[model samples]
Target: MKATIERATLLKSLGHVQSVVERRNTIPILSNVLIDASADGTIRLMATDLDLQIVENVQAQVEVAGATTVSAHTLFDIARKLPEGSQVRIEAADGKMLVQAGRARFNLQTLPRDDFPVIAEGPLPTSFELPATALVQIIDKTRFAISTEETRYYLNGIFLHVAEDPAPVLKAAATDGHRLARVTVARPDGAEGMPDIIIPRKCIAELRKLLDEVDGSVHIDLSPSKIRFDLGNAVLTSKLIDGTFPDYSRVIPTGNDKLLKIDPRSFEEGVDRVATIATEKTRAVKMAVEKDKITLSVTSPENGTAAEEVPGDYSSAPIEIGFNARYLLDILGQIEGDSVEVHLADAAAPTLIREGEKATALYVLMPMRV
Candidate 1:
């Protein structure tokens, strides 16, 4: 196929789709991207790893109506290094694909289009449309908790399901063995029959990137085994995990009443400073709250102790808790307020966190042994 596309635009699109393509492949065509050109000023790009797939459509000035397959990474690299805003011409030759822009010419290896694996688009049983911001919020809240353990394969993905808590709501949750993160939102009308799908971490990351550019909404496609997202120019499809996620609803605390409101910046900074002396294996920061102050301290057998006292709005009975410094930082990164609310019952109980705005976002962290 002969097609003329702007180098920058084509490069960006290739970079997005090519990310899913694995480098060393048993199947030769798996590293190549399918390019189809039509006389109607449109060119489409598609790539897959068999388990996951992405299809993108670009507006190109087409000269000939045909299709071909070329190396996705090589083409992307060549276009990106070219002079800024140069027009790129791609044409299929006898045995290779030719890439030309101004003074630079690249002959990239190609594979037969027939060898490319194409995942048939399944008829989605349940479909819904939601704002990109909402999807981003759920992912941002729960993705950090996703387990990295390959053995407990079910916990390696974010669980998206409808649960009856705080109402019949849409929720996402993930956890390794140490900590758990769960977030719930009121389900929309179209989500009535939304099947519970476990979305892999890689899918969440790619979807997050695409959602960044979306202004308003996104279409969600789901089957029991797969999930698909349709944006304006791009489409993402991922294979869902077949196993079941752990029952995490019972893990979140409901009776923790004592609350400590401390400056998020101060609390975060104190933990950071103290954790510097903490051992790498533990990374524990201890918190002791008094009348109007919260003290963060850390001690290591080899290294001396480090401590910092920060002024807070703590009135509840004094509470001392131990937590991983890294987990505290992750929670603080998502909170957007001057003061952070820490809900506690005792040292052994899970600590609930909020940044004054309860409806906005809430975080719960398990206490670590000091």
Candidate 2:
């Protein structure tokens, strides 16, 4: 295969697909990206790591119509370091791929295109079109809470399903024993009766990258075992986790009636300052809420105690709760509004957090004994 592609165009396309290739591979062909050139002025680049695959198409000047494979990381690095506006000419000859741009030239070993594994496409039973912005909002607000524990494989991904209560909505939720995040958006067209799916953590990350570059609609196709995303010039497919996510609705609190409204910035700053004295292992911060003020304090056996008082609007009886400082900061960071509303039952119950009056996103954090 031979083609000439602009450095910037090739670099961007490679950046999108190369990330799927693993750095170390037992099968040599798995490290290479399949490049196919067509006479109609386009080049297709594909890479995979058994479970996940990404394919991207970019405009190029094609001199020969054929296919070849080369190391994905090496090719991406070469394209990135080339002169900005220079044209990159690539050709396969004598079991090697030659890359040339301006005064620099390099030859990389090539693998037979036939040896590359291709993920088979099957009939997708459900399909829908969703705005890129909506998908980004759901993933960003919940991905942080996904469990990293390997033993409980079911909680390692985001649970996506539809809610029909007050109104129809698409929801995404994630939890790790310590905290949970849930977000909802208006249901998209053609999403009715869609089966619930658990999208793996890696898939969520790759889809997020693709959405960051485009502002159009993303086509989603799903079946019982697999999921696919069509992002205009790029396509991503992955195997769905083979386990059922727990019923997250039960984990969310419904009877936490005590309310505390405070400026998010002030609460975040106070938590940050007092957390310095917390021990590295526990990193626990104690919060005491009274009529008009919330005091955050951290005490460590080796380190001195630190406390900060922040003004808040709370009329409930005095309550003291202890929580992991890092977990509190993560939930606070996702709040977009100036004020945060925290619902509490008591020191032993899980606290519910939300941004102002928005019901689209909510967080539940478990308390730790101080």
Candidate 3:
């Protein structure tokens, strides 16, 4: 394989695909990226970890139509260090690949392209195109709640499905037992009968990065077991978690009537300051809500105590609740509006949070004893 590509363009494409390659691999080919140069003036860079794969195509001057495999990290590092505006020449022969730019040169061993494992995408029947902004909003607002526990593999991703909250809406939700995040957007044209699927955490994270550089919309194709995302020149295919997500609707409380509205920025700051004195394990903070103010306090045997009063609008009967300070800050960070609404039934029941009264994003956090 031989091709010539700009340093910046090559580096960016390599950066996208190489992230799928594992640093430590039992199979040598899994550590390398497949470089395919076509006569039509483009080069394809593909990398995979058996479960997830990313293929990126970049415009280049192709001199030969051939394919070869080379260390993904090594090529990325070389391309990254090349000077700006330099032309990169890549050629493979005699089981080695040569990379040259200006005065720097390096020869790296190549693996046979046939040895690379390809995750077969059987048939993705469910396909839809959604605006990139809507997709980004769904991921950014909920991914923080994805679980990392290995045993509950089903909870390690975001649950995506269409919902009928009086009308059809596309929803994405994630939870780690302690906290839950759910965001919804108007249902798109082609997503009416789509099946519910759990998108793994790692895939959500990697896909999020790609979406940052993309505009317009993204094409998504999926089956019960796999999903494929087409973002212009880049395509990402990932295996879905083969497990059932819990009935999240049952966990979302609907009878919480007490309402307290507070400035999100002030509440966030107060929670952060008092959390410094909270225990390292629990990170608990106590909130004593009155008619006009909410007092946040924390106590730790090793770190002493701290307290701060955040002004809020509350007219219901007074209630005291304890919560994990870190979780409170996380939900607060996602509130984009000026005011944050906290609906409470009591200290033991789960607390519901949202950005004012009409926000599409909803967060539920379970309280912890202080």
What order do you get sorting by lDDT, best first?
A: 3, 2, 1
Q: How many clashes (backbone atoms < 3 Å, residues ≥3 apart in a chain or on different chains) does model 3 have? A: 0
Residue-level lDDT of model 2, residues 55-130, one tens digit each, is 9999999999888999999999999899999999999977898999999999999988989898886888889998
On the 0 to 100 scale, the lDDT of residue 250 in model 3 is 91
lDDT of 3 by residue, 49-103 (tens): 9999999899999999899999999999999999999999999988999999999
lDDT of 3 at 217: 96
Question: What is the clash tally of candidate 2?
Answer: 0
RMSD of 1: 1.7
Poorest 10 consecutive residues by lDDT, candidate 2 = 351-360
Q: What is the Å distance of residue 127 in model 2 from its true position?
A: 0.7
Please, what is the TM-score per model? 0.95, 0.98, 0.98
Q: What is the C-alpha lDDT of each candidate?
A: 0.85, 0.92, 0.93
Stretches off by above 4 angstroms in model 3 are none
Tell me the TM-score of model 3.
Answer: 0.98
Model 1 has an lDDT value of 0.85
